[model samples]
Target: MNTLNEINWFPGHMKKALDQIKERLKTCDGVIEIGDSRAPISSFPTYLDKLVADKAKFYIFSKADLADRNALEKHLDKYTALGINTLALNLTDRRAMQTLINRLSLVRTRQEERFLKLGFPAPSKRFLVLGIPNVGKSTLINSLAKKKKAAVENKPGKTRSESLIKVSDKVFIIDTPGILEPNYEDKNIVIKLAILGSIRNDILPLIPLTDYLLEYLLKHYPQRIYERYHVSLDGNCEEIYLRIAKERNFVSKNQSDSERARSTLLTEFRNGLLGGISLDE
Candidate 1:
């Protein structure tokens, strides 16, 4: 992998998005911070610490279907201890929609006092969906609305601007572009984000990222590699990737197609074919 400082993770639009968020935040009553359940901590932006300090923040661990129950429970316990309300959700599940509505309803009640103290009558509750790319910020909006109000795609940074959607008469949502800081302070967090598909695959080299994923999977989920491709948890990451490549016949024309194998491994891992693994433990 290249040095973390060398890679330009943030683009111009993301910076503009941050400014837009701060400007738009003034009208919002609370924030629904979406994070990948597979990597809750890393996916949650640190810049939001001060940004959401005064706002009612509800943390949602999105895509729980791809995470381990044990790891998810552990993260839930940690956040609960901190007094932050959190919900683990699979956006495809209809029940999760109702669960979110009920939770946000409670959040509105909790924040009403804060609003009243500010010399204002409690008005409609507005929530901005904030998270890194491809963490389902838009998907949550679409799910809640039960219609395609916001564009839904399986790519990061698809939401380039904020669009309002009315989920209920009193509840509103703003879907914004995934906000990553202009710079990455820690490379491991970047790798974690890349591994979880929050960042686009093209931003980084495939082999290095795949190598990191290999190490990460072996550490956090040893059995998954064997289960999916019959590749045992053995040898270094490159050797393991090579082994899988050879096993899957990724080689042809007298040369091994390591790139194709890497893509396959990453896609399967992202698609949850490697079992329910969590990188945020």
Candidate 2:
């Protein structure tokens, strides 16, 4: 797998966002941390978790519509066993918003109890919404708010400021800019993030990222590619992609367009055309 050394992922804005989030956490009563369901464990930043660990936290696996159900449960169970309120939900699911609200009500109730015991007036339940880029933070906010209250985009790093949104009468959400960890020593983790589109599209090359995704599916979810692309997984990744290109007539004069083929593969995976695949392994 490519180590993704060429990606200029951490911009000055993200560094500044981290500092701003640290300061903003001071006013929040809880945290609603989102992560991609395809690579839930990897996309959940350990550093950010450490920062919000003391707060009443709810861990959400967004884009559950694009992840393997079995693999998703495996990941969710890991967090649940740690006693963290964890849920796997696709933003489009109508029930997701209510389920989330139910879980958050617990956080609010706990906050109320805390304020009572501490002899402080209990204000509205305030939660800081945070996660890596492209993790559906904005979309989730819009869903919770029951309107287009937050600017939502499919790309990474779209939302850039901290804003307070009133989702319900008794609950408020602090929306923060998505930020990656300052250091990513694990290349595999970065690769998974890229594969899941959590990393910015321009930050990493699609060829290498798709190649890693190729090898991963070949190893763990070969049936997915076979069913979706009708391509055999009997050879190296290059050979497999070429086979797909050949089968789909994605070629020029009998030669596969490497760029086009890789892009197609990545787009298929990202769009869930390859079925519910997971990079949790």
- Candidate 1: tens digits of C-alpha lDDT, residues 181-203: 67666688898898887778788
lDDT tens digits, residue span 1-281, model 2: 44466666789999999999989988887888888888877898667867877788888898889999998998888888998888889986656788788777767546688787999977688899989988988888888877787787778888888678887667889788888876788878887887777777877777778888888888898787888778778878788888888877887776886667888888888999988877877
Winner by lDDT: 1
**Can you give the lDDT of residue 129 in candidate 2?**
92
lDDT on C-alpha atoms for all candidate structures? 0.83, 0.82
Candidate 1 minimal-lDDT segment of 10 residues: 102-111
What C-alpha root-mean-square deviation, in Å, does candidate 2 show against the real structure? 2.1
The Cα RMSD in angstroms, rounded to one decimal, for candidate 1 relative to the true structure is 2.2
Which has the greatest TM-score? 1
RMSD of every candidate to native, in Å, equals 2.2, 2.1
Q: Estimate candidate 2's alpha-carbon lDDT, on a 0 to 1 scale.
A: 0.82
